[model samples]
Target: MTAPQPNTAATAKARLFGPGGLRDEYTQLATRGRQSDSESREWSGLSVGHRMAMLLLAGVDGDLADLATRDWRELPGPEREAIKSEVRAAKVAFSRLVSLSGRW
Candidate 1:
């Protein structure tokens, strides 16, 4: 059998940003936001907390695979809720931003 070939888009995305998965894309966006200041551009990016929330949303395949993962619960109730909201909102906002920017 031959070795598997990686999806170039996914590979490039993961290398420059994250773990190279759809869910991972959320986290990558956060990092990209930090590295750049363009609000319109960075909306797609996320903070570390945002990444964790998105991973959680993605279910079993989510990034928070390990039980040893940090205590998201320990955060203040408001903070936790806010992060969750941000993750959910991000899916819509990011896509709209990307579409409008036409940079893709």
Candidate 2:
């Protein structure tokens, strides 16, 4: 029997937020200078915007981190629009979380 061919095309989420993507980039920045596995666990618990804020505080490029919450223009129209909507909700949630925290 012949083996099935691998699907080489990256999925929308993988292309936008998986390895080597903007989310990974920000995660790398946020976790920089850390020295323990427990810290990794803690970092994993953080939301996307919190990770972005950590990256900002670490003096990394804010533009790169901001890309996570933006649409992936490289994707075709429908997929792009879908991902954009999802990211928009994430941005709104993050903003509300930050705003609520500030009031505490």
Candidate 3:
């Protein structure tokens, strides 16, 4: 008698950085002090490019945040290739990652 579960993509997004989730928690904290400052505040220790890589990975049904959580030890080749292809085709951009990551 198990309840139904959301698909992997939905569950992953909901868990990874959704509201009240860990990533959102830090992102919220970092942006809290930037209102009166001229310079934009930085996000959780993750670099913009690395963060971009995560979102790109997410978009393609890959688990980059998982990799990051695991410190990028080793991810599968096809998954990595798919993400790279998406980036190269200009189907998406790194800024999209930041934008989506901030979206909630």
Candidate 4:
């Protein structure tokens, strides 16, 4: 039998930016010493679409997942809210594309 295929998206992302590339953010989140399961999973989900967006934008730091952080809140409340809204909207759009891919 063929070996089970891996999550290639996650694998490719790891190669491009090392495993758990957001070490700094994760570290800060786990300042108490270790991360809980929920924190780890949350970071993984949040990074997916954000990573894809960075790849599409061809940002100079596109290959660096550690670039993500909670610093968005440092902005004024209105601007921070606007940025969060855009990110959520973009994530929804990307999910639609994922749902439509293949099966044609």
Evaluate model 2: give its TM-score: 0.28
Colliding pairs, model 1:
29-45, 29-46, 30-45, 30-46
RMSD value for candidate 4: 17.5
- The sequence of per-residue lDDT tens digits that candidate 1 reaches over residues 36-89 is 334323333545555555556534242353421434432335644655576568
Those runs of model 2 whose alpha carbons end farther than 4 Å from true positions after fitting are: 1-36, 66-104
lDDT of 2 by residue, 1-104 (tens): 99976665656568655646776566557878342255344545667786565444434443745543442332245543454455566677777675567856
Report RMSD (Å) for each prediction in the order shown: 15.0, 13.6, 14.9, 17.5
- The clash count for each model shown is 4, 0, 0, 0
The global Cα lDDT (0 to 1) of model 1 is: 0.50
Encode model 3's per-residue lDDT on 21-86: one tens digit a residue: 666556558887332222112223557566566456546454545544432213345654654565
Question: Which candidate has the top score in TM-score?
Answer: 4
Looking at model 1, residue 96 earns an lDDT score of 72
Q: How do the predictions measure up, each by TM-score? A: 0.27, 0.28, 0.28, 0.30
For candidate 4, give the lDDT: 0.51
Write model 4 residue lDDT over 45-99, tens digit each, in one string.
5665574454344332333444354333222355444444665777887787855
The pairs that clash in candidate 4 are: none
